[model samples]
Target: MSTPDQPAAFKPPANDPWKGFRGVCSGTLILESIVVFLAIPAIAKLGEGVGAGAVVYLVVLGVVMILACGVQSRPWAMGLNLGLQVALIAGWFVHPAVGAMGLLFAAVWVYMLYLRKDIQARIERGLLPGQRD
Candidate 1:
């Protein structure tokens, strides 16, 4: 059913769990930071329905994301990103106005995960200009 020239799919071990988690974490930090920068202030001024606590949460999460994104390794990023995503998702239930931002964050996180297959290759061979991985 398969040809010799075809390469097998690269799958991280199920037991490792953390690999996927780290990828999500890394993506979360990057995306969440952007959302917070744009959404929180907008909601504060435009909506006026979202409370100060929600704004405070976004600011704090932004700070944590800044620290988490500084890590160079992918696995580390994944863990942090997972925690961050969980926090954002949880926030959605507590604050629907803020929760809307998670959709954007989730979209970016999924997109980043889709490109994760090249992580090792990029670390070894280097990324070309405008390359996705």
Candidate 2:
């Protein structure tokens, strides 16, 4: 029996696939935000001659990373995350450690994107036998 307040069946969340790849990406972004912020004081201590602008840039980047993570489920968010990766790589000039972090995150980002595509393909081709279409 069905009622106006209840459907005849239940539906799972469609947007997240491949065991919550989007969730993984979102978590990675939040973690990156924290790492970026933690590097701020080190940037100041480097004393190879840094300006307030450097700190400001890192702060703004950290904030953007956190905010963007919240919207990772949106299609455009993939691009935003990639852009942040590039920025992180560019931050290498500030310190080699930032570049290393960027490389690691970039690798994870690529893996997530690849997984998403694979999952979508399986869903479309009806090959994912254990799951609903």
Question: What RMSD value applies to candidate 2?
Answer: 7.5
What is the TM-score (0 to 1) of candidate 2?
0.74
Provide the clashing-pair count of each candidate structure: 7, 0
Give the lDDT of residue 6 in candidate 1. 71
Model 1 has how many clashing residue pairs?
A: 7
Q: Pick the candidate with the highest lDDT.
A: 2
Let me know the TM-score candidate 1 reaches against the reference structure.
0.58
Best by TM-score: 2
**Candidate 2 residue lDDT tens string, 15-116:** 445447777888889898999998887766765755677677788989999999778767798999999999998888867877888899899889878887
- Cα deviation of 100 in candidate 1 (Å)? 2.0
lDDT of each: 0.63, 0.79
